[model samples]
Target: MSRSGVAMSRRTRLDSELVRRGLARSREQAVAAITAGRVLVGGIPATKAATVVDGSTSIAVTKGDDPGYASRGAHKLLGAFEAFGVPAPGPEPGPGAEIPRSTGPTLVVAGRRCLDVGASTGGFTDVLLRYGAGTVVAVDVGYGQLLWRLRCDPRVRVLDRTNARNLTPAEIGDRVDLVVGDLSFISLALVLPALRACAVPDADFVLLVKPQFEVGRERLGPGGVVRDTALHAEAVHDVAASAAMLDLGVRGVTASPLPGPAGNVEYLLWLAAGAPPLDADVLAGAIAAGPAGPGRRA
Candidate 1:
């Protein structure tokens, strides 16, 4: 049989194969597992969900669940908390239990009303809740994408089909104490002003900075990945500048612990309302000390 024919004969997409073998509950879960570096095929880490393999190939999930989060995006926020020294509160406190206090200017999620933009699958929202957010307003432009458990959680207010760019304080009901976002297909510049309007004077932010979306299409590498280190730096700088224009201080910048789906290295940007931007040298040092990976140019 020809190569195409052979591929069509018994080969299956890795996500489908994972579902067929009962390794994943659905193709979405399988893709999450694959991109999170948890799925291995014949002892090799699978990089793409659409990779085709023969029927007899061995496939396994290195971890049974998505590390207890609703989606892999939770890991990104969790990593930011650790990297920035933001304290996450423990489980619901008993009558005499005390909430942990933040050591620095890093935002503490405990007891804070938060806003989660681009809250698809409720991953960031889940992280907020896990860290003891008093309440979370989950907003997404798309409808019906949040997880059922999050939608049912009393603390999460679902705002499906809502555009973050047009959000107002009246719409959000009250000013938020903190904001977390993981937006795609749009620049954070367009939404930062709106987020600023919806937050309190000293509210902090932890937003995922996706270079693939920030950089122009002409700069993207194959599969829409931002492979140039200078472009990565430019993207981060642009976002920081935009935040500065809004009077939101750039608290810190760090590379994401996990790469994007197309193997692009993403970044986490920490900001606070009405604070001064970090020193350029300090920001550069933080980026250098962050997790390094394949696409980082020397």
Candidate 2:
């Protein structure tokens, strides 16, 4: 404040001021420095790292470090976006669309009886509803873990403690137009059969591919991670091949924008019932890029 020869403005927490001023490298770094007792404010040491500060505050960092994602698996999805050319999710321009133009355009799940095989916390289900799906039958083995926001939504019908393999057309009482899955502890091969049973000709399929599950237990690295790129490729191919055999056309393959827990990379395979098979090489290349990663317009 003295530098400006004006009354030193009310002081502020150094880290907050830095972030507010776009001076600090990152919020994580600011917090880390404050936690490490390396940040000073107004020529005095600050105690709590998250303390608030003002524009006049002076700060210094004692070290350098890398900031991390909400989850480490974010990097895998980031890799997918880099490889694929799918548009990143962003704010859509203008008004009048039933679906808000922003927050990523909804994939056509609306008015179509749909199923989310592994609807944990309902991320996909959330996306499905945003797209104006008539109803989403969200099935998961776990109980009461869906996001509260989705559970309260009228469009969703939660089916906890249900196994996808056990689902039948009779239970739904109607055929499904789209069946999206994100299962764990089971291979897509096992789940595909049940989905086939539920779909009519011309139905759409979107399932997640986790190399950790598709590959043999032996190939999994420490902590149940699958780090091999080649194995990742094989897992995608195996799922697509199985779908092809079921007479489900492999429409497209993309990476999820969000990574799975335990940092395992995941994939999204789009399929259509009764559609012709896709060329293997083309399909593989599309997945190698961000199938569901960046470039997705919101």
Candidate 3:
């Protein structure tokens, strides 16, 4: 018991506490917020998901703004689209306001038949829809994680329990013109083969590259983050190598505008039929092109 006669109980994870307080929808969402520099505790930014804070800790999100997508991932995919000049559907998310989207087929999201692998909570799906994808097949290994709004939309074909590793064009019915993915807990190399098998002859994809999941655990530094810039390049090259073997040409690799959950810096790898992975020097430059993240979050 403290001076106020309130007991300070057991310390719990910051992410779980955020969920318990309804500040975030899930632990994953909480971590996403924290990593995006959206979460603050006791007037300070939260640097990791494992921050041991009490349930009553003074936790709050930055500015109470709607982070655009269903989760912070919307910012990530949007960053990829804009940085790569792909463009997505919908208005820019900010100032508690929504931005309007383009009208027709863009070089990317607009008017495309798309697939969203690991579409948890529909951040990527929301981007696709807002950008004008003719249709979206939301595939996830888990069940019932997509937002209800996306679930009810007729244009979205929900495929729950569908592992991207096992996905085939036959399963999706028609080839998708564009594919966007945000997967966790598995190396992308395992999912690339299936993603290749399900795309249109010249389909393109924008997928999040998580280094912690790609590099063996033994290589991860404290708090399970890849702190070495060299390792970041290696992970990209390794995954680019995987894509090449499948004949999915790598277009570019850019550091995500946002860090991944738990402050893990992530990259967006663009793949298509014609382009090849950026040469080592070019890729190194791209990896450092965006905002220098992984600062406070670490």
Candidate 4:
């Protein structure tokens, strides 16, 4: 059903499709997640779980919108840790490699104070807690959105109706050791300054980068997806450059094991205070690897 007069394929409900694809374990879980706005179709947020979609339409679960793991996004962070070798979780990429995997010392969080931005449903917070973080300050722009379980947990300090752009060390009581963020809608450029302000002089960070939100609207294509590889590269480059300006050293950039809702390819940009930004060649190499498909395993 297009101007070309091509026949349209059959459509299915978002929740049912999730179960059909094994993206969700059960219909009830799918419905709960979808109703919570955790599902996206064709790069746009689906308003209803029952919305119909055709084969050409790509549907994906929003990161951190899972019924389990505090948020579906917890898996994404765990993958980042393993891939980035945060606390050295997996194999280290060889020299001259575009991205390094599994190479950091086991920097466990037994005594680390943490900050979770875009702490929607406390997905990242959950990960920190599971790793034995000392304290977790969860910040989000919405109210009553965090699951009651985490909202009431002693280890989690919920700061609802708060914006990362306005965050302060005073608000958090102290600078943090670990800062993990999974934000949406806003560009990283806008939030990095606030993060810089709230982080300890040497805080380590792992931030989720959604290209659709970072790339200018002009760079986006139909359905708000940024399909052009060059545009994708530029999106990440711009974010890295912004961090450089703030003196946050680049650790590495890797394709997320999970894509953004609506199937937009996303990345995890790791940084730390006082470390050097990655050389241009290394940056370019990572870009050449591209973010178009299921990328190399970290």
Candidate 5:
């Protein structure tokens, strides 16, 4: 309790608290508002990257409207679905499964189970459900970061404070047809095996590749953002190589529709188990050309 007669305790990360309480749609949006000098900590402007503050501090945002989903990550995946022709999963016939259907021959998630790695604020989970996924096991290392809207969603299974790198198939209880990851800070190589364990043969994967994390520490600029075009290409190559090592085929790579925190450029890659992956030249060409824009409609 403060002298102002406010109960302030249980310090929490500003970004996560914003999502959990429905003040923001996603942690990315909260970070955006905070970085833009829009977020208030105890009625004062805050700009730190990750600040722990009392939940009762009367946090407010100068921004007028909140995001459409819990996190900006949703828009990134939405871009892939639009660019690559991935469609919504089909209706659930009965109790437990959902199948996906595409307008063309593109693979769908109509009746597939999914795992959302780094499911903070449940933005990806939210997208998965909206596309009619029967069930999405949303996992994040941080606790209580999932938005109430996502938490209340019957199709999403919230797994807070759980690291995807440590996950096992037994923990998930069934093989999944799709796996999507938007992980940060760690190398994808370390977590790919864990995610692979959860996927059934022929399952597809969509991963957000953050060059800042994939490149060597020396390549990163201030605030941990990657900016060099060469570095971006190298990072993508590293991820492609790693996927190949796992016997996962990289079908395609596309730039994210949205820039990451601090305006870092990012890429999204689609991989399928047992299918032939994209060649190095193809991956490099995609990077050079940039994400297939809205002009390349799905």
Candidate 6:
């Protein structure tokens, strides 16, 4: 029943409606805007992208709500790079400009091939490209979630509906110099082997560690967040051990600058093939210094 005496059509998803109404250029942008609390329905804030609305329902995007990236996951990777002092590629030197030489061993991203596991909406992939990765193969289990601009970028190869646990080097066509991941619902241990198989020798890795997925269900507090600091340490330690068994060294670990979508305090793990295992003391210190609090609804 409509106020104007016209029957409303079937409900449409908020993200799709944003696209249909030209409020957003793509579903990815719509999701980002929604997640950032910028989307309004009938003059009230809309919380979820999956929310359904009728044809006549009013929708609005808040002004000046840009997040500066396709997804907030970009901040997680950026934080890791800063905490670990990983070198970002500088702008190209103009003709005859002086080139600076490195004084120590550094994980260089310039002109390097990369693999982005669980690259939904291409947040991490966007950061990699901005930092100067030459090529990025974005793999996700779901279909049609990447930003349209990233899909059109020649440097990005979209591998939608592909499971990372079964990923192979042959499919990627070449060994990657770096690997970055921001997976959900799945344990990193299950996909570490596949990631290792697709990387070059001595390749670098920056993976988000979601404690809620790594810790057993019994350990999770309300709302699926690992609130106990001890549990957080245990989860990270277990994943680091798993990587070690696969010959992947845990180079560093740090808390993400921003909490996860659910306000779960997530971690960023830096790994490298053939590097030394992470020291137990360093692991403990990182967990102790991490964001101290329980998860909350964002």
| TM-score list, all predictions | 0.72, 0.63, 0.70, 0.69, 0.69, 0.71
Q: Give the per-residue lDDT digits (tens) of candidate 5, residues 212-258.
A: 88997887898888878888878877887788888987766778767
lDDT, candidates in the order shown: 0.79, 0.64, 0.77, 0.73, 0.74, 0.79
Ranking by TM-score: 1, 6, 3, 5, 4, 2
lDDT of 1 at 8: 41
lDDT of 1: 0.79
Model 1: how far residue 137 lies from native, Å: 0.1
User: Distance from true position, residue 189, model 4, in Å?
Assistant: 0.7
Please give, for residues 184-267, the per-residue lDDT of candidate 3 as tens digits: 989999999889888877998888989999989999999998988888888888888898888777766667767877888898
State which candidate, 1 or 5, has the greater lDDT.
Answer: 1
Clashing pairs in 6: none
- For all predictions, the C-alpha RMSD in Å is 10.7, 12.4, 10.8, 11.4, 14.5, 13.6
Give the Å shift of residue 251 in candidate 3. 1.8
For candidate 4, write residues 128-230 as lDDT tens digits: 7866789999999998888888888898898999999999999999899988999998999999999988988888888888889998878788888877767
Best by TM-score: 1
Better structure of 4 and 6 per lDDT:
6
Estimate, for each residue in 10-41, the C-alpha lDDT of model 2 and write its tens digit: 65545556666664665444544543346667
The alpha-carbon deviation from the true structure for residue 6 of candidate 1, after best TM-score superposition, in angstroms, is: 53
> Which run of 10 residues does model 4 get worst, by summed lDDT?
289-298
For residues 1-298, write the lDDT of model 1, one tens digit per residue.
7766654448767877888889888655675676557888899676655567777898878965564677878767766775566543433457985654544455577899999999999989998887789999999999999999999999999999999999999988999999999999999999999999999988988899998999889989988988787788888889989999988877667777667888888888888866666566655665664443111211
Question: Looking at model 3, which ten-residue stretch has the lowest summed lDDT?
Answer: 289-298
RMSD in Å for candidate 3, one decimal? 10.8
Superposed on all Cα atoms, model 2 deviates from the true structure by an RMSD in Å of 12.4
